[model samples]
Target: MKQEYEALFTPWKIGNLEIKNRIVLAPMGGTCIFGWMEPGGSHFDKEAARLLLKIAKHDCGLIIPGIAPVKDMLGGKWLYQNKRKFAELAEFMDELHATGAKMFVQMTAGFGRSFALTAPLAMLAKNKALNTLAKPYIDAEYLTAAPSVLPNRWADDVTTRAITEKEIKDIIYAFGETARLCKEAGVDGVEVHAVHEGYLLDQFTLKYTNKRTDDYGGSFENRYRFAAEIVKEIKDKCGDDFPVSLRYSVRSMTKAFQYGAMPGEDFEEIGRDMEESERAAKFLQDAGYDMLNCDNGTYDAWYWAHPPQYMPQNCNLEDVEHIKKFVDIPVVCAGKMEPDVGAKAVKEGGIDAMAVGRQFLADPKWVSKIKKGREEEIRPCICCHSACFNLTKHNGTANDQDLTESAGMCKCAVNPRSMQSKKYRVKPTDKPKRVAIIGGGVGGMEAARILALRGHEAEIYEKTSELGGVFIAAAAPEFKEKDKQLIAWQKHQLKKLGVKIHYNYEVKPDSLPSADEYIIATGAEANRIPIPGAADYAMDATDYLLGRKQVGKDVVIIGGGLTGCEIALDLFRKGKNPQIVEMKDDLIAVKNMCLANTSYLRDCFKTNKVPVYLNAGVAEITDKSVKVNLKDGRTVELPADDVIMSVGYHPIPLLQAAKNVHLLGDCKKVGNIRSAIWGAWDIAMKI
Candidate 1:
């Protein structure tokens, strides 16, 4: 192991329990061992269990599987009532213990107003009779009940009614009963999922969300009584030695409803502040919580908790370190934590452990790689919540995500076999054959790698000298360092796998190479909109990103999609003034994009004073200015030294159809990295 990471390998203790190392597998949403959002009664989710066990076997010290709701979403049965699942878990625990890893089941009180409401769920919430009929199957009302009546995070029409005191008491009792079952099942401990992330229990703690005069809300102690009582109940049911970790938010970086404060932005916090967090940290610790697994932000400021690439490394470290001073119990910092930074923090006693979540989904063997001093071989998580946890919401859409993705969270965009082992496994082919993959983008490279792994001779043919295709331009920004790393990782994997590459050789459909099968990954071309003088005055998004075109101080971006907004932010950071014009009502109003990723860019633009023109279209581009048509039917000329068009892309395949020929990636359908990689895997496995 490297010298810097030595501290991370050292032993750490959470209460009386000793963990072999300081790396903790943080809980995500859908990796729950007891199942999540399913229609039937709670049962042991073997898929999730298999994923967690793999991580444990790979040398993770402490494994905390995703949030297991104390009450089942369907049928609303208490978790303790599912005794069969506990028995299964007990047997699984014995197997996990053989790997020398401790296990903690994260139990959630529920998602109160923070419940991500879908369109159907919003309808069920608004119509009383519909909700009554759906109660047995979904219980949308019970799922969304909060400390006080508040608008749902994802839906404007859906309101979460104030939860009754009886429900609160029932939930507290459920925590005790569940903890007891976990203890009897031979589980090491249980982590409350939490008085954090603006969930049901967290709603009771925040003054803005909790307006009740009942015993659960009012003074600081009253506001925190819900959390304090949970730990106390767990201690009473299980022994005091049974370690309980609290998934804590050191500070809530929220500004208003559905708005978040950008990192380092000056704003008055509407959620929990630092002063209250310090006191609450000590209070919750004194109330029998053995450890504090800490981060920041609520559902309103979701980016701080579920940070994307734009967030700085160790984004939650400073606050977590500060909170550690207030509590004697062990502290684990999560949220984009770098391994080296975490090691330094652990060595200096800044934090006891480093909690990592999404990275494990990207590479389950990351810990083993680190210990073996082969960190470069480990795949890096680019933090694109494209496939995993992409519960999207915008100005007018409610949870605009595919229902399949909503149910199956924690699947990595880069690694297909993380949560989906059965679907995307590497098996030896019965017959090995030479395969040719056109284009050297991520999709083509992934196909070649998988084909080679399955005992096939695969080669890539690229038109350019480099391998990453348009992704090279996409990773040009400083904030997108992880994207660049991904490109490098793919190149390295292809080289190590001995996949032959023919660069600077573009193959025409008539001049195809001799191969048993062919994969067409020619990618897409940028859409050029017809506008007066645009052909002469405007450049494509890739031109600016690739440094082929330069923009002056006053720049106008023709689209407010993810690419345009990112370009605007990149320009602004580089000391250039950039303005955005979009026909949509909101920026990045696309489906399958996580709110955490989009909210960060939106908040950054707002904080940096980047001018945005929404519901507007660019009519024409002049040499020094661009004419825009506003939503109010007014034409305005904006000062623009240069114009960059980011209207989107269209696939341009070299070969449409042929026997033994398949298309993948943007050439087949223009989607994100998840689609490209998964599509490649599906085709590669078949071949």
Candidate 2:
């Protein structure tokens, strides 16, 4: 093990509890020991327990699973009512304790206005009578109720009503009961699901959300009264010796409703500032909290809490370190935290521990691998959030996520086996066959790797010299270092698996390789606009991203999708002026992409003053300008030194129908990495 990382391996104390190491598995949305968002009473989720137990065995010091609501979402039963689940957890904890790791059940009060409203739920909330009818099963009104009346985060039309004092008291009582139950279940401690992320409890704490004139609003103490009461209740019920951790956000980092402040941007905070956070930290500690599991951001500024690749490494360290001074209790920082940096902070008394969330979903053995000085073998999390916790929302949309993803939240995009152990696990096949994978992109490589793991002869044919196909171009941005790391990791895996690769060998349909089965992962070609002068003036998005072409001082990007928006941001960062023209109503207006990732790009564009023309289409391209037609039937010519086309892609498969031939990735359908890898897995498993 590296000497610099020794501090991370050292024991740490949170109240009377002593953790074996400084690595804390921060809670995610779906990996709760208790089921989340299901239409039934709370029960022990074996799948979630299996994943957590694996992490515990991997040398994680403290394990915190996803938020287990104090009240069940569907049945509206208090969590303490489900004593059988706690009994099951008690048995599970014996196995977990054998691994020398402590566990914490993070109990959430509720989402309130931050509840990610789906289209069907939004409909229920809009009609009072329908909501009343649905209250017995799935109460949309109660679920969306906030500290005060506020607009729902995902749905624009739905307004959350202010929660009553009676409901607040009920929830506080529930927290105490739940914490007591967790302690009885052999759980080491409990972390409050937060006075962070602008959830119900956070809504009560923030002045922007809590407008009540009564005991729970206005003044700082009043605003935080609900949170203070929760810890006090838990301490009173479970005894003061039982540690209680608070999920604390050092600053809100929000500017307005549905708007977030970008990193390094100068803006007036509309949510919690440092001054109040300093005072609140001390107050909450004094109130009975044992530790602070800290980060920054609300649901509005979600990128700060659930950071994408665009966010810097150790994004929340400085703020978390500063907050540590205000409270004597241990502080743990999350949000894109790097291990070495976290280790240094732990050694310097900057922070007590480092909390990591999504990376565990990407690679459960990362800690063990790091401890063995095999960091390169660890799979990297690209922070795409495509498969995991991608509750997407855009203009004129609700949550907009697929129902399956909404229910199963913590599945990793890169590593399929994170939450899904049974379905995606590698098993040796008795009947081995030679598999030829066409194209050396992510999908092809993944297919080859899986086949080789299944005791089959697997080989990849690449047209280009490199393995990463369009993803190489996609990951070329400076901010996409993790993506680059992923590519390296994949290459290393392929080499280690002994998968054969033929570079600069493009396979035509007529000139196919001699294999029992053929997997086509030829990828996609960029769609070019048919406008006049486009061929001469406009370059493909890949051209710019791959550094094959350069853009001048002023640039116009056609298509306001994720690729186009990211390019615009990249150009803006390079001190080049970039404008966007889109036919859609909003940028990245697609389902299954995380708001945390998209919102950062959207907010960055808005903050940097990058011109974005929505509901607009390109009419023609010129050498120095591009003519665009607006939604109002008006044509305008914008000055442009260069034109970049990022409209979309179309699959160009080698063969559509052939015996023993299967198509995956962009060759089958033009989609993101999630589709490509999962598609590869589906086909590879069958073969």
Candidate 3:
């Protein structure tokens, strides 16, 4: 019987170029630092080129870069500053073109978040010349324009200056120059990234930010003029032969904002009410856009934009159909789009093409796996946002969890060798070694699974009753239940590879069996913070959220990292007034991994009036009250019936005694679950 997905596997074409299949690798940011610039621009690293070529050979018809900065001198908000010569970029472009896959570059203006990073870099350089007091002015000045004028809900009371007319002109010119460069680089096309609630484009589009009374503000047509002119300029520079794709979302994941400031009560409302979105699409298409990539949500409201499993897969296919009816040009749909779901969308004629993001991260050989009908073998994107989203947000670097540290290299979560496909194949080793893995946490489980797959007799000794380590903490949050699936999948894979697992067997380093080598996966320990009344009132958020213990009515949580935020949410779910106090100005530094959801969670907390005090320190703790030092250097007292300590966790250093031992997961370094698992996999593969 012919499969419904065969249509998706069939040959297709865009403009004069021909392609093999309908599956397209949506232009996604490959690395974190190049927020608005292509890695090909300045990061002319060999590994980046190799990664791109490997992705091209994966049977995907069209492959789009996450983004490429379209600037001349490279001075934009969050955009990447390219110092490398144009010749280097041209060489990378030639290699991608030779891979038999159509290539496009995603382009966007800088978002306010970019300033949060660039501000500090500039401040550091200035501080070396000046002093500490002068540093604040530089930081404040950058923030004033990047986020303050833009009005970000995530930013901590930072002020920004409104962009002047001269700055706007420079931006338009930058976009034009970038397009010209992309054309010179010999790329197939450029996708205008006016979505994902990132950069200058989305910031201008969201009405909540554009309150200025000028040509760039007021009505929908006026707000979209800058983008329209930029798209027009690109078309004029690249010519009609080069296909230009425009990626936009009708809803802002942030809450009330959407592309061009549209609002969506539900999915259907987003499509129906956003006349400006359709108008902008028509304007760009009329101006010469060949394709439209539609998705839902913005960054301010984040969760809706990068919709996870909590929302249905292919959640915005209907939005694509709505726009498809209005425009004659091809429509591309993205947002948690699965293989079968994408195939069905194409088969049913709901959309012309399918754009995938996290799926490619989960399995880069996604198109190849689908072409061969090995759907089950394709590792699905669990959407933990650890690798892609988190890294992009905080550090501005691509998640190299599974790949080597070489710059511009693309990596995956499940398959460590996905980006390094050319370097290593799933072939049996020359000589199989008997491996002993202690502790069934992420690191141990990963090592055991990979070693067994390499034809090694791998035996895992779990000290506790379960295999998962801090991954269990993922399920402790109100919206992180999906993480449990990933942990279960890892366990299932380990068992399928014929790994020997022994639970509740505590083995010290000396008591362990002798093998070729040993892997110590003994995870991390919780940091115990000293306070006056800690013993009676303080409990680790992990312990409280995991249902190991109950929290009190008026609870205060110290530390505002990802762990603390989740604990607060768990307390909120329990109908408690959660007060989170952090020494830092911002709540969580690792927010990129869980963008939209974080916005939603923050809003929920604020709406419920849950107190969140920043730049506050706990001066004293007692049974009846807790004293805090405010940013103004004043002390305030609040009742602390209960307290949760989320200060931070430390590695369990007892593993140092074991000879030829390796550490993985939070035990070695405090990081996401992907890091621990991938760390284990890498070490085991070499062993």
Structural similarity to truth (TM-score) of each candidate: 0.99, 0.99, 0.75
* Pairs in clash, predicted candidate 2: none
Better of 1 and 3 by TM-score: 1
Q: Per-residue lDDT for 269-300 in model 3, tens only?
A: 22223576666667667767788878876554
Task: Quantify how close model 3 is to the true structure by its C-alpha RMSD in Å.
Answer: 6.5
Highest lDDT among the candidates is held by which one? 2
Clash count, predicted structure 1: 0
Worst 10 residues of 3 by lDDT: 397-406
What tens digits encode model 2's per-residue C-alpha lDDT throughout 1-687? 999999999998999899999999999999989996676867899999999999999999999999999999878888898889989999999999999999999999999899999999999999999998988888899999999999999999999999999999999999999999889889999999899989889999998898999999999999999999999999989999999999989999999999999888789998999998999999999999999999999999999999998999999999999999988999999999999999999999999999999999999989999999999999999989998889999999999998888888899888888788989978889999998999999989999989999999999999988999999999998999999999999999999999999999978878989999999898889997788989999999999998999889999999999999889988988999999999999999999889999999999888878999999988889998999999999999999999999999999999894779998998888999898888888888888
True lDDT of residue 551, candidate 1 = 84
Looking at model 1, residue 36 earns an lDDT score of: 64
- Overall local distance difference test of candidate 1: 0.92
On residues 320-364, what C-alpha lDDT tens digit does candidate 1 reach at each position? 999999989999999999999999999999999999999999999
lDDT pick, better of 1 and 2: 2
After superposition on all C-alphas, the RMSD of every candidate to the true structure, in Å, is 0.9, 0.9, 6.5
Candidate 3, backbone clash total: 30
Relative to the true structure, candidate 1 reaches a TM of 0.99
